[model samples]
Target: MHKIKRDDLVKVIAGKDRNKQGKVLNIDAKNNKVTVEGVNMITKHVKPSAGNQQGGIVQKEAAFDISNVMLVVNGTATRVGFEVKDGKKVRVAKATGKVID
Candidate 1:
């Protein structure tokens, strides 16, 4: 399993949006990138298309290097750890040593 999953609360630890927290929207495991809501906003100019009647400059979230984000646990950013519990691997918060369910 990946350390960061969809809907997980994460905080950008690097780049222009450093320290900004947002929910994880998508994960690109092959590229090691993740898209977070309200982070890495980029404007794109689009021509009018059949699907989109009014296509102009639109703002959207862009994927960032997963290494640049840290998972948020208990309202704080923490490193992820793994341990076996009940014969199954489970995620743990390094900072608090608590199981992340």
Candidate 2:
């Protein structure tokens, strides 16, 4: 299972945005990357198109490697670990004693 999912709060553990917390916007499982809202912003210049009438420099979030982020759980960012409880799979937040369903 993917540790990061849409709407999941996460903290950037590495890169220029380290320590920044944001919600997960998208995930590219095949590439092992995720786009966190307001993190890793990049500028892209686009040519004017019929659909985008005023295509120009646009600032947007870029995907970062999933390994560089830690999921925020119970008010703290922590490493996620999995275990079986009552024959059901579960993930735990190492920083706090909480189960991530």
Candidate 3:
């Protein structure tokens, strides 16, 4: 399983959005990238289409390298670690040593 997953709260540790925190909207595991809500926003100009008659410049979140972000645990950014719990491997927060589920 990936250390970061969809709907996870993450903090951008690198790039233009450094230090900014947002919820993960999607994860492109194959590309090692993630799209976070309200982060790495980009503008796309779209022509009018049947789906969107008023298509125009739209601001949306762009995917960023997964390495650029860290999981937020207990309100702080922290590295993830794996541990054996109840005979199962589980994620843990390095900063607080708490189970991350």
**Of 1 and 2, the candidate ranking higher by lDDT:** 1
lDDT of model 3, residue 26: 96
Q: Which candidate is the best by TM-score?
A: 1
- How high a TM-score does candidate 1 get? 0.97
For candidate 3, list the clashing residue pairs, or say none: none
Q: Put the candidates in lDDT order, highest first.
A: 1, 3, 2
Using TM-score, rank the candidates from best to worst.
Answer: 1, 3, 2
Q: Which tens-of-lDDT digit does each residue in 1-101 have in candidate 2?
A: 77678899999999999999999999999999999999999999989999899999999999989999999987688888888899987888877758898
Stretches of candidate 1 exceeding 4 Å from the true structure: none
**Count of clashes, each model:** 0, 0, 0
Least accurate 10 contiguous residues by lDDT in model 2 = 89-98
Model 3 weakest lDDT span, ten residues long: 1-10
Residue range 55-95, candidate 3, lDDT tens digits? 99999999989999999998999999999999999999999
Q: For candidate 2, report its TM-score.
A: 0.89
Write candidate 1's Cα lDDT for 3-77 as tens digits.
Answer: 999999999999999999999999999999999999999999999999998999999999989999999999999
